[model samples]
Target: MRTAATILDFQHVTKKFGKTIAVNDVTFQVKEGEVYGLLGPNGAGKTTVIKSIVGHLRPSSGSITISSYDLQKEFADAIDFVGAVVEYPMHYEYMSGYQNLKLTANMYPEVTKARIEEVIELVGLQGRIDEPVRKYSLGMRQRLALAQSILNYPQLLILDEPMNGLDPLGMRDLRNLLRSLAANGMSILVSSHILEEMELMCDRIGIMSHGYMIAERNMDEIHHAQTPVYLVRVNDPEEALKLLSEEYGEQLHAKEAVGGRIEVETTLISASQINRILIKAGIEVQEIHEKKQSLEELYLQLTGGAEIE
Candidate 1:
């Protein structure tokens, strides 16, 4: 099987503001057609990293390359492959969406009227394409911004807080759109406070904390790596807890009696073994199932409960 090429590469990149180190020695890569999510709390340097990629802020040291072109050495060539909607989408409120798109299209030599129509349809803004920007909802405005961003057919797309003001339906629409784009070979780097959405949208995620890339993992691997918390219900919860506690002792990671059920957390013992033990001890084993740790739970555990900004 052929490996995908790296679309975005960050090599020991660091960014500082006077005395404050906003980003420190971060190294990661976004592969072709991959959706890479950037996650962090407020002041964790996620914005700093995004700004550095978009050329809004220059790195203090190290290197960054997009689509194989050096960001600092061949800035024009590097930036040509990038399209971004940083912070929030901006447009003239008085002008129509079509007019705004036309204005943005003027900046790119290859953006044609047919291409504009194609993007309008791609973002599901066909009916509202000619509507005044001020008359459009936040979701509509976001769609327009997305349409503008992809007008030049950029190989890499960057989105910062793209779902900030969007509703459930709008969020789902945007998510599906991004998935479709990635499927068609456009690599995306996105940062968001919405962990649940990020978990659903991204193939892999890189977590930042206090300006450091603390953790990076594939979503599939995260799912597989989760230690299962088995919820086992029994006729006698107290007896089951006592028996397991005495039998396992320190080997039992955690054991709690929740109403009539016993929630057991362990990596050393299997759920079937627990069930067999209870059954053999004359304790009726009712229902038992495993609950895996979610992305939000993992994020909280990793960040020490720091609230996502």
Candidate 2:
């Protein structure tokens, strides 16, 4: 179980670009050892929120605190506990991966050669650490960037679309790495358009739309929030549908699905109960199971089917 200590807090933060409101009164928190996901479609102000958190842009109103240090008042101190890869991981392409890390390590007084080597190994880039970054694959570069971010052993890490150009293997590797980090007590705030990945990675998610936070929910809560829908395949689907409808009435909705299956929608009824009802009514139940709801479906429902970009 994760602790209740809040690692990062955004309280009614708002950011404006002249006449345009990029982020409006958004508030959320990342607890210690939690992986928090920020999800939204294009033009949903996800970038603005990330920027504000990373100090690229200041919130016009409200407050942001990192490890209890106010971002506006104690900029340096608040940022000390943060490590971020916003938008893209920038590096000196001509420099070797080791060299790039060495340069970054120069910024932190306590980062020793042993610490640098440790991070490289931790990121699984030890073998190719001496290679020029220009020759590294996108995944390798991302790993290097992650190594750089954690060189100082920060309490919170923020990533923006860290999976953008990664292949399946790369994505899996990064996902495992993140989960491992979170398990060891690193709080992460990541923004991404990939709903499936977010669903797998985040403990809780805050969804944004049109510059406003529409919803913030734990993964388990989101899953449970879905109305349980069951697909029942029987000898007589039409009869089963009619029997269910007549018996359950407003308690559930039953309809004929493709392939002569009965699609049952209900929150008040269980699959086993429906099966028993059908069997008791002389209907032969061939199969009965609840249809799992995906995070993409939930996201679509919350965003009004907005295209995830």
Mark the regions of model 2 whose C-alpha exceeds 4 Å error after superposition.
Answer: 1-3, 222-293
TM-scores, all models, native as reference: 0.80, 0.79
Give the alpha carbon lDDT tens digit for every residue of 1-309 in model 1. 789999999999999899999999999999999999998888888888999999999999989999889999999999999999888688999999999999999998888899999999988899988878999897888888989999998899999878877889878988999999999999999997678889989999998888999999799977676666888999988888899888887767546656688888888889899889899999999899886567777788788884754
Each prediction's whole-model lDDT (CA): 0.89, 0.89
Clash pairs (backbone) in predicted model 2: none
What is the model-wide C-alpha lDDT for candidate 2?
Answer: 0.89
Candidate 1: list runs displaced more than 4 Å.
224-269, 272-291
TM-score of 1: 0.80
